[model samples]
Target: MLVLAIFVGAGAFIWPQLHGYAVTGAAYGARVACSCRFVGGRALGDCRKDFEPGMDLITLTEDTAARSVTARFPLIARQTATYRDGWGCVLETWRN
Candidate 1:
């Protein structure tokens, strides 16, 4: 019971920050990939190289019709950024 309580306490304290990290990371990734693919005129496929070397869990998807990119970290968080023709990338949502 003591161990379980300790685990629960730790989880409660840690989970929110963990989620925050994932959300921030995904948002940054989305913005970077969007800029690379749209403003920089780089191929969408090549934007995978923009992610940090160890961050294989993050995934990036592109929507040609919307001119946007989305980055997701499984169940934790996801963020999308859209590219305007002359303005570069802007986040679709204010929060991740």
Candidate 2:
């Protein structure tokens, strides 16, 4: 029971930080992938090569019809970015 309690405490402390990182990672991945796919004319699968190190947990999906990319960090966070003619890639509005 002590070990379980310790794990719970550790999770409580770590979860917020982990969620923050996931949110940033997801947003970055979505924007970068969107730009890569739309502006650079690259395949969505190839866009993973553009991610910074330590972003391996982020995964990307594309809506070609919408010219948008969505990135997810497992169950932690998800974000979408869409390409605009003049604005390049723009992130979706965040919702509470």
Candidate 3:
């Protein structure tokens, strides 16, 4: 019971920061992977090589038909970016 309370307390404090970082990481991963896959003409699986070392928690998925990539950080955050002819890769607008 005491351990559970402590865990809850810690989680309440840490969750917001963790969620914020996850959001940023997901957005960055989506944009980078989109560009790598669509603009660089690389396979989606191969785009992980382009991410920074600490981004392992982010997972990327490609929409070949839409020319976009979506990235997720476990249950915390998700974001998408699409490739355009003139704009390169553009992140989708965030919604509340």
**What order do you get sorting by TM-score, best first?**
2, 3, 1
Worst 10 residues of 1 by lDDT: 87-96
Q: Write model 1 residue lDDT over 3-52, tens digit each, in one string.
A: 99999999999999989988888988899999999888899879888878
* Pairs in clash, predicted candidate 1: none
The positional error of residue 94 in candidate 1, measured at the CA in angstroms, is 3.3
Question: Top model by lDDT, which number?
Answer: 2
Model 3 segments beyond 4 Å from truth? none
- Candidate 2 C-alpha lDDT tens digits along 1-96: 999999999999999898888888899999999999999999999999999999988989999999999999998899999999999999998532
Over 15-79, each residue of candidate 3 has an lDDT whose tens digit, in order, gives: 98998899999999999999999999999999999999999899988888999999999988999
Per-prediction tally of clashes: 0, 0, 0
Top candidate, metric TM-score? 2
What TM-score, computed on C-alpha atoms, does each candidate reach? 0.84, 0.93, 0.93
Candidate 1 local Cα displacement, residue 10, angstroms: 2.0
Sort the candidates on lDDT, descending order: 2, 3, 1
Alpha-carbon shift of residue 8 in model 1 (angstroms)? 2.9
Who is ahead in TM-score, 1 or 2? 2
Off by over 4 Å in 1: 1-4
Off by over 4 Å in 2: none
Model 3: lDDT equals: 0.92
